[model samples]
Target: MAHFDASRMLSFDLETTSADPMEARIVTSALVSIDGAQTDMLEMLADPGIEIPEEAARIHGITTEKARAEGQPHDEVLAETVRRIKKAWEEGFALVVYNAPFDLTVLRQLTGSFTVTGPVYDPYTVDNIKDRYRKGRRTLTDVSKHYGVTLDNAHEATSDAIAAARIAWKQVNKVYPDLKAMSTDELMEFQAVGYYDNQENRRKYFESRGRDGSSVNTSWPMQD
Candidate 1:
């Protein structure tokens, strides 16, 4: 395995008002910067400007009342979050998101533009690609446990983000060792190809299971 400095990574996650990225608004988000043994984290909560459904609130524990009372406005929070992510990218930190499409797509929709550029590492996609034969669910928590990373508070943004970073670290050592040798731009290109390939594979899997694979999105970063 190639050795890489962990400090040159940024891990991020978002808790949203709903499961559908196009419809949901970000309720909470976490951005973590890792460097060796040192780490910095920023956590933000935003008022989504709509009623948070009970089921969605139960998932992440952020109700509309709590958001309205304690959170920043959506626009301000989103702008600042995008600014931080862009800054991290420009500074050469590889962005590590647990599930890149959901969070990145949501961010793109909220900002009305593509704000996060990377060497973006989506542990979800990478894990799926690396372990296609593994059975059972591949949730972040599941993959983290499989990789021997502790993920406390599964649905919470900060905890999930940190866990994702740790999982990516472990995955690189265990599976995608070549990733360590790639430049940020090259890794971005690699993921762009891998994302679509995985999507096509997933579509075939669903179709083989007699499910509707047509709805599966082939787009990465954002579903077109």
Candidate 2:
């Protein structure tokens, strides 16, 4: 079991080179203080082991030339990112990813292709995507609109990560009324077992994509 602390949550997001998280390469990533006081940005040119599509480059501004010129080695950058996140998780921190399925799926995909040094904070994650739809909203943009949070530069990871923190802080308190009263451990337990049905759209997505058949990273918990 695990726990959550508002201050210990690391809201994160990644900007990748493609729409399919399983195949995309992370061009940039950002982690923001759960309290919204400070932030850190890690922008890198991922080798991607493939060509960087022009459309994707236009989205996050990471071109192949730029990556070859200044981006850290892909494996090194990934190892460090996992290391940092794992360090925080070991300290009782829970990561707040807007859509846990997308980012975590990307991470697992990358791990299958490359060597990742440590575990990511997936089990203790709060999925804002699932939460939003459960509340009858359509998208992150819709939830952001409802919460009055500024969503500047929607696709970039840095902006998205910060927005995720603000979103989590806003929604958790609103939907889970006793969030503050629960200890970090209790909060984690609550989120892990929380009950809410999926929207029809998501159910259809899983059906069409055939992605709901089985758990992918079932053994991640035992990884070092």
Candidate 3:
């Protein structure tokens, strides 16, 4: 197995206006590039052109007034965000995200023209696959805590993104050591296949429990 370099990865996360990716507008986002002992971080806040809901604001602490007054225009934010992400991909940095589907879906909705081409590393999905029976919660905070990584700010995009990268690094070194052998492209393929496999298993589990399984999405990155 080839040794993986954690510092070479790019970690991304988003804070949105709501829970539903399709309807929610991205309020803030962070992209962090880790290189050796150095780290570069970019953060963007978009006005979203809509009122930020009270509950959502309570969660992330970005109120509608704050967003409108301080955030950049939605289109401009989306364009720059897509540009940076694509640049990172072109530079061959493996993308690490925490619940990638939600963020990727929101990104697609906002950018419309951008497509997610991966070698993506989703720590959420990877953790589920590695420890299917570990109960309670699988949220970014929970996962970080499980991996003994400190997440100082829970809802903030930059903190969450960095924590996710750290958790993924730990998981690779501790749980799925064999994955170290795979190149980023190979890792991406593995994630795609594993996503479908896990979806199928979840569908079967729901069916066995006489629950509706149709809502379970088979797609990775986004549901179509």
Per-candidate TM equals: 0.92, 0.70, 0.93
lDDT of each: 0.83, 0.59, 0.84
Which candidate number maximizes TM-score?
3
Error of 2 at 24 (Å): 1.9
Worst 10 residues of 2 by lDDT: 215-224
On a 0 to 100 scale, what is the lDDT of residue 173 in model 1? 69
What candidate 3 gets wrong by more than 4 Å, as runs, is 1-4
RMSD of every prediction: 2.4, 5.4, 1.9
Report the number of the highest-lDDT candidate: 3
Candidate 3's displacement at residue 139, Å, is 0.6
Residues 7-108 of candidate 1: C-alpha lDDT, one tens digit per residue: 578899999987888887989989999977879999999999999999999989999999999999988888888888899877777788887889988988
Q: What are the runs in model 2 whose C-alpha is more than 4 Å off?
A: 1-3, 34-41, 113-138, 181-196, 199-224
